[model samples]
Target: LVRTGFEHLYEVYEKIDPKGARLLEESEPYVLTYLDFPKEHAHWIRTNNLCERLNKEIKKRTRVVGVFPLKQAMLRLVGAVCINQNEEWFVATHFMDKRSLLFEELPQREACTQETIDHLLQVIDSDFKVCREVA
Candidate 1:
């Protein structure tokens, strides 16, 4: 049904405005990504409402704070907001029917290189030690 509607729109655009149709054709691959996901999940995947809402909330909170004393303080404030939002979502109405989710496992991430692992370990080890001598 969605694909049929998309095709009809393309046909109309091609007839009325060939340039507009060409632009749409260039974006066809990206626009059709929603169809690749489960129908139940398509609406959320196709929209930016969730991210826009979260960004608005963050901006409102930060506006009240004006300026943070440290980078860590800013991070803590945003992290707290995210935690609250996460808790709210658990109790809120379903975004999509829970039963419709496929619950498929995601592909495993690539392993970190030895150099990256060693650098991370160094940082972790340094964090446990004092930055300056006590005198």
Candidate 2:
């Protein structure tokens, strides 16, 4: 629904800003330039460009490496990359600002009791028409 890049900012700002053109011009410089996120919600942000670039880099590396010695080495390499990506994602301002809306301050609300799990399994089975969905 939303276009990527500064367009998303400009669109939202159009509706939110009271000053109209002047505010848009002044704010455009800030929004279009770099992400200026607050410290509190300084997590959860990403750009597809960065993801594509990283994937390209990983592919290039894979081509160079050719093969892994074992599955563990592959897992370790992928896990390290995931950690680095998570670090980067937390720092991006747009993501940090927006992502907080999607989550709660408290831990996830999960009912993990045996009865709850059984009920969950039954519901899932009924919905999907697949029994023994898990091993």
Candidate 3:
């Protein structure tokens, strides 16, 4: 459904922004790449809060330092923060269900839910009838 909904977007990107379009095209496969993972892992990995939290921490720490003597110093600080964050995650209880991972991967695609269909129809204010359908 994501691919179907984004077809027009991909086309528009291709025409007006070739570079972005190229990147999108290259990354198209990874759009559903989450499907390759176990169903249990998807929910946790789907939201980027972990990344956001890490970035926020990095920004907060960097602000405290105020200034760096060199570019490598900033990088080293960032790396240290990342390593610290990784250790924290390792010590914390895992959010994924290991039992669910024992199972195989899930279906790659699914039909849109009724709620989604209705919401989109309401937003578009149309049944999305093409000119041919009107004719």
Candidate with top lDDT is: 3
For candidate 2, lDDT tens digit of each residue in 1-135? 111323434444455454674566676665533333333433323335767867876676667667999999877777777677778777866554565456445343333566755565555445433432542
List where candidate 3 sits over 4 angstroms from the true fold. 105-110, 113-135
Ten contiguous residues with the weakest lDDT in model 1: 126-135
Better of 1 and 2 by TM-score: 1
Candidate 1 C-alpha lDDT tens digits along 31-78: 887656565576777888887888888999999999899999999999
TM-score of each: 0.49, 0.33, 0.67
Name the better of 2 and 3 by lDDT. 3
Local distance difference test, each candidate: 0.70, 0.54, 0.74
Name every residue pair that clashes in candidate 2. Answer: 45-95
Query: In model 2, what lDDT does residue 112 have?
Result: 54
TM-score of candidate 2 to 2 decimals: 0.33
lDDT at 95 for candidate 1?
A: 71
**How would the candidate models be sorted by lDDT, starting from the highest?**
3, 1, 2
Q: Pairs clashing in candidate 1?
A: none
Q: Residues 19-72, candidate 3, lDDT per residue (tens digit)?
A: 998888888787866656775587788888999999999999999999999999
